[model samples]
Target: MNPTPPPTIVIVPGLRDHVADHWQTRLAQRLTAAGRAVHTVPPLTGERLALDAQVANLAATLTPLSGPVLLVAHSAGVITTVHWAARHSADVRGAILATPPDFETPLPDGYPTPAELAHHGWTPVPREPLAFPSIVAASADDPLGAPERVAAMARAWGSHLVDLGAVGHLNPASGHGDWPLAEELIATLESGPALAPIGATPTGEPG
Candidate 1:
C-alpha cells in the first residue's frame, strides 16, 4: 500500500506582480524544501470577473486532491480565499489570512476603487465564520486595514487573530523574508483534530 500523501499547501498571492523576494514566494520555497506540495494561483489581471473566476478555479483545483488542503493567503489573496470558502468550505482544512486589505477604506490610486470593489462582488466581504480552522494575521501598522478593522474581521470569521506588529502587509517591504513562524502556525493547524468541524480558540497577540 502507498503511504498517505502530504497535504497540499495552496499559496494564493495578492494583486499585481509576484515579486521574487516576497514572503509568500519565500514561504512557498521553504515549504517545497520541506517536502510539501505547493500550488500557487497564477496572478490575475485585477479585473472583477477574472478575480471571481480565479476563486472558482481554486475550487476546481482542490476537487481532485486526496489529502487535506491548507491555504496561505496575503493581501487581496485573503479576500479571494474567504470568498472561495464561503462556497467551498468542505475542501479546505485551514487558512492563514495575512494582511488582508479593507475594501471599505480608500485604496491607493490604480487599485480597485470602492465602486469596483462592489462591482467585483468583493463588497459585503464574507464575515461568516469559516467552516474550517483559520487564523487571521494582521500587521499593527498595515495601511490597507486598520488593526481594529482586521481584528473585527477575524472575530466575524470566528478565526484566531495574530497581531504581527508594524509589518506592512507582511510583504517584502516589511522586511519579513523567510518567516520562520509560519511553520509553527502551519503545524498548529495540521495537528488539530482532523474531524472537528468547529475551529480552535482565537490565537495570537491582540492586534
Candidate 2:
C-alpha cells in the first residue's frame, strides 16, 4: 500500500484557534477535504510564553512532517512563524503569512499597541533572507499593519507580498469566512518554490 502522504498543510492559528465561521477554519477544512493532511498546532499566547518557547513549539510541530510543509499563519501567528523560519528555515518548505501585524510600528485601534507588547521583547524583522520561499499577504486597510510596512517586511524576508484590497486583518471581522485565495496560495506553495507576483490576483486555481 502507498505510504500515507506527508502532511501538506500546517495551520498556525493566532492567539486562539479560529473562531466559529472564521476563514482560517474554512481554509483548513477545505484543504483537508481536498486530500491534504492538515496539522493545526495549538495557539500560543504570546503573553504567557517566552518567544523562545513559542519558537520551540512551532519547531516541534514541524518535526513530524516527512515532506515539504506549507505553513499558513495569521495575525500574531505570522510573527511567531517568521521568527521560527529565521532560525529553522530548512525544516519548512514555504509559508503564507496573512495580515502580519507590524511588530515595529505602533499598534492601532482594536489591536495590541507596540508599547503594550514591547515588554515581551518583540523584535524587528531580521535583516537576513529567509532560507526558503514565502509569501506575506496584507490588506490595504489592515488596522494592525500599514501596507507599506508590510511590503517592507516581505522584502526583508525575501517573500512575495499580496495586497489584499481593503480586507481588514483578513479575519472573521473582515467578513472572510471562506478564504479561497489563501487555500490556492498554500496549494501553490506545496507544488514548487516560485510564487506569483504580489498584485497578481489568485483565482483559486487548484493545482
Candidate 3:
C-alpha cells in the first residue's frame, strides 16, 4: 500500500509573532526546506493583542488545508489554539502547546498586564478538554507560567504533560533555539496514540 501522507504542520507564534530567530519560525523554515506542507499565522498589525482576532486568524490559516493538520504553538499561541479548539475541532489531528503563559496572573515587567489580557479577551483561558489529542511541554522555571500552573493547565486540557525542567519559557530569550524536541513531540502526536488522561502526573520529556 502507498504510504500515508504526512500531516500539514501549522506554526503558531506567540504574541510577539514571527520573530526572526524564534524556534517556531526556524522550525517552519526548516520543515518547508525539507519539503513539508507548512503554514504560519501572520502577525496582525492592528489588534495584535486581541484574542478573538488571533483565533480567527488561526482559523483562517487552517481553513484551506485539506489533510490532517498538526499545530505547534508557543506561549500566547498556545492560548489561542485552546480557544480555537473550544469551538472548532475538525481537521486538526493534534497539537504541541509549549510553555503557555499564565495570562490571568500578573506578568513580569515588559509583558501585558492581567487587565490588558482580560480586556483583549485572553483571560479565563479555556480549561475544557481539547477537540484533538495534544501534548503540552512545560518549563519548570517559566517566568510567565509557574510549573504548577502549567501542570494544571495540561491536566485540564487532557494533554500529556512533558515536564521540561528549568527551561525558562523555552523561548529565544530563555536560551533555546532550534528546539529539536519539537519535532519529536509532533511525531508522537502524528503516530496517533491517545494522550495521558486529564489529571495524570507530569512526565519527563516524550521520546
**Best by the TM-score measure:** 3
CA deviation > 4 Å runs, candidate 2? 1-7, 45-49, 196-207
Residues 1-207 of candidate 3 have per-residue lDDT tens digits of 998789999988888755887889888998999999999989888888999999999999999889899999999999999999887766888999999999988999999999999999998999998878888898888999998888888889988888778889887887888788888888899888776664564545422
Cα lDDT of model 2 by residue, 105-164, tens digit: 877676555665665655755656778778888788888888888887888887888767
Which runs in model 3 stand beyond 4 Å of their true positions? 198-207
Candidate 1: global Cα-lDDT? 0.77
Superposed Cα deviation of residue 193, candidate 3 (Å): 2.0
Choose 1 or 2, whichever is better by TM-score: 1
Error of 2 at 2 (Å): 6.4
Regions of candidate 1 where Cα sits further than 4 Å from its true position: 1-4, 45-49, 193-207
